[model samples]
Target: MTAAAAMVRVEGLCKRFSVPRREAGLRAALRALVRREYRVVEAVRDLEFSLAPGERVGFLGPNGAGKTTTLKMLAGLIVPSAGRVEVAGFTPSDRRPEFLRRVSLVMGQKRQLSWDLPAIDNFEFNRVVYEIDPVHYKRRLEELTALLDVGEVMRRPVRQLSLGERMKCELVAALLHGPQVLFLDEPTIGLDVSMQLGIREFIRRYNAEHGATVILTSHYMEDVAALCPRILVIDGGRLRFDGSIEALRRQIRPLRRVSVRAAALPDDPTAMGRVVLREGGRLVLDVAPERVPEVVGALVALPEAQDLAVHDAPLEEVMRALFGREEAADLGGAIGHAR
Candidate 1:
């Protein structure tokens, strides 16, 4: 897609950093002071993707997989070493004021709001920074507060609020201007399950109402499952998988897991499927997708079978297997994220 038509567009994106190599120990530190050994690290390489307005997509990867680097580039916080990035019709590296006004970046590791003030005060500050009219700001604030359920605690000091409460207010502050695009980097980190669910719901509602384009990077699989229909998976500073969540599940791990709770132990669990896990009265089997129905039928017909359930393999295991395959094959080619 061209830059003008895409909410976000990237072509041959790369970000490289030179780092000083130093070993742990007083002698090594002292020696490195006079003569430093430098190493080039590529955070992102030849990355290309585009997003249309109102699309909610998840960015997935292990640590050091360039997720944050890509987000920072899109947010215009840093310039790429090479390549192009246009967000909302403006080149992010240019740091255009108009582009900044139409988007917001919420990073779990960083806070844009003042630490010493109440969340309401931060929201008011954003209103002034964005030059929002008083009437419109008030209306937006009311709507966000109602949606996030932060009405009562808006006046409370941000420092005193729990992590989850602070996260909700942080979202309100970031969104006070009604940004058209949002870059969320681990927005639900460090929150309880209920609070995480609330944040996920708020994100979905906000996107549905405003047609906001959202790029979410989160470790919680459930958050991605609930919010993103599509996902971009990166590994070792390169794109590994980009497609629907189901497609990723199928490509990385084609097997289905069938768990059966049996009334008694079977003479041979392998007859049903490859025994993956077994305990007191429960047997977990890894069966090919095509064989899942057959295996389940056979197991259900067994006299000892009590109950059976089938599920796709866990995402963590899929990723682990993917990386393992990459290591064995040594294939570092970038995978394009298709719309």
Candidate 2:
């Protein structure tokens, strides 16, 4: 069997920032000037991972967890304080034209297009920057316009476009060079549900058609569920989990949720499972995964049963539990434990 190639590789990767220490009073500030005070913050700590070609992976973390910092390292925006990192056969810190031409970074909070200029103008600018051929440029523009459903908004000034429209144009600009790898940070932030789903679908189709490798950091769990098959969750400047979504869910929330609609529930439903909810003739229970069949059996045998269904806990709930557990572990001084 042929060994698979990695699109990105990172080993012992670390980033540190020097933060100044300030005092409340003027006297303290004056004393600090004579002898400065500083604190070193470790943003990323000895992280090691690799991504195979065409893999769509979610990079998740809480605020200050270094999700964006790691992305910047991969995008060549910031150099790592320690360790080795490479993307598409190039060290991102080197920022070679050839290497840069093969990857693109789209930061939702940052704008690549000029605010007063039409969105199409930004595309033209990227074409020159990447030195794309005119034929290829037009073809890519047409394809992205169709996929993102932004053909009509392309000619409008960026300032005149809606937030959703501007986001679509940004995606187009990022892809104008036909990069094989994409780094997306908070891509769906601030968009309505309909627009978020639109962006999600477009990204899915683009990945399917082009076999591009995507590494995304999104606060929206729905986006992760819809687009990423695998997820790498980081917390407290370290990787907590790295695996398929199913595996992560199973590891953190092993219990299954079984809900039933009936005329009435048992007097003490906790005997069967912990009652999750009871309202309007519906009953929800959290049962051990191994006992789901037994619990559902008892519910099925009830004469008042109207309907029954069993499923894993919602991804958001699972993730919350995971983070809570991680926090507890950190407080307990078990920082080396892997999820």
Candidate 3:
């Protein structure tokens, strides 16, 4: 796509931080009272990717893997030490008013709403901060509050709200201005399954309706798998893979999970595939992709077979396989077709 067609354009994006270097001792601390040592850590290395409007993309990585750093750079919260980042056709680090107005960020571990203030008050404050027209603001506030089921909840102080409720309010505040880009860092960090699903559906619906570009960083693989069709895996401050979840699954872990419950099973299940579980009336195998059909047929023929299934390996297994590889693993384009 042309430059004009892409809503988020990142090329050779990089960030580094000068961290204070210290040893764990009072002697070392006293020595550093006048002069302290520092070490430069490369938080984000050269990264290149782009997203079209209305696309929900995720940044997946382990702790301190630069996923959040990359998001911060794109959101203009931190300036990159090198490389370029353009969001909505404006340089993010420049922090221009127009660019700031076009983007909103919601962090799960951080609170944007005032703890002492009611969430509705926070939403009204955002309206003034974004300089949104009163008529449009009222309509959007109503729309978002109703959709998120927070009409009455928003009247309570933020500190009194549940984690999920506060997050819903955070989303409402970020979106009142109708930003073209949304940055979400762990939007469902500490919520029950039902609450997570509700927020996930809300985000998906909002993106669908508003045509906003969403870039997410989350430790919950299910959230990424559910909300994003495309993901960029970052490891060691570099891009390890960039593709759909299915493609990533096929790349790092191509094994198909074939399982069945039956009265009788093969004496040597290992002959068919790698055995995952072997219990009375049930057997699960991680079969090679090419052998899946044969394995399924054999499993179905088992005496009194039931609950037969053939499916790609779970996303967690795929990610574990990817990250378990040595740091010397090949670059983004080279890793492929591993079973």
RMSD of each: 1.9, 3.0, 2.1
Instruction: Estimate candidate 3's alpha-carbon lDDT, on a 0 to 1 scale.
Output: 0.90
Question: How high is the lDDT of residue 200 in model 1?
Answer: 97
Range of the 10 consecutive residues with the lowest summed lDDT in candidate 2: 330-339
Better of 2 and 3 by lDDT: 3
Q: Scored by Cα lDDT, where does model 2 land?
A: 0.87
Relative to the true structure, candidate 2 has a C-alpha RMSD (angstroms) of: 3.0
Stretches of candidate 2 above 4 Å error? 1-4, 25-36, 326-339
Q: Give the TM-score of candidate 3.
A: 0.96
Per residue, candidate 1 scores C-alpha lDDT tens digits across 99-146 of: 999999897777876788999889988988999999999899999999
Write candidate 2's Cα lDDT for 1-339 as tens digits. 012388888889999999989888999899888988899999999887888889899987778889999999999989999999989889999999999999998988988889999999889989899999999999999999999989889999999999999999999999989899999999999999999999999989989999999999999999998899888888777887777777777777888999999877777889888899988788999999888888999898766897799988888898788777735344223222322
- Candidate 3 C-alpha error for residue 81, in Å: 0.5
- lDDT top scorer: 3
The C-alpha TM-scores of every prediction are: 0.94, 0.92, 0.96
Model 3 clash pairs? Answer: none
Q: Residues 238-292, candidate 3, lDDT per residue (tens digit)?
A: 8887778988887777888988999999999998999999988889999999888
Predicted structure with the largest TM-score when compared to the true one: 3
Write down the TM-score for model 1.
Answer: 0.94
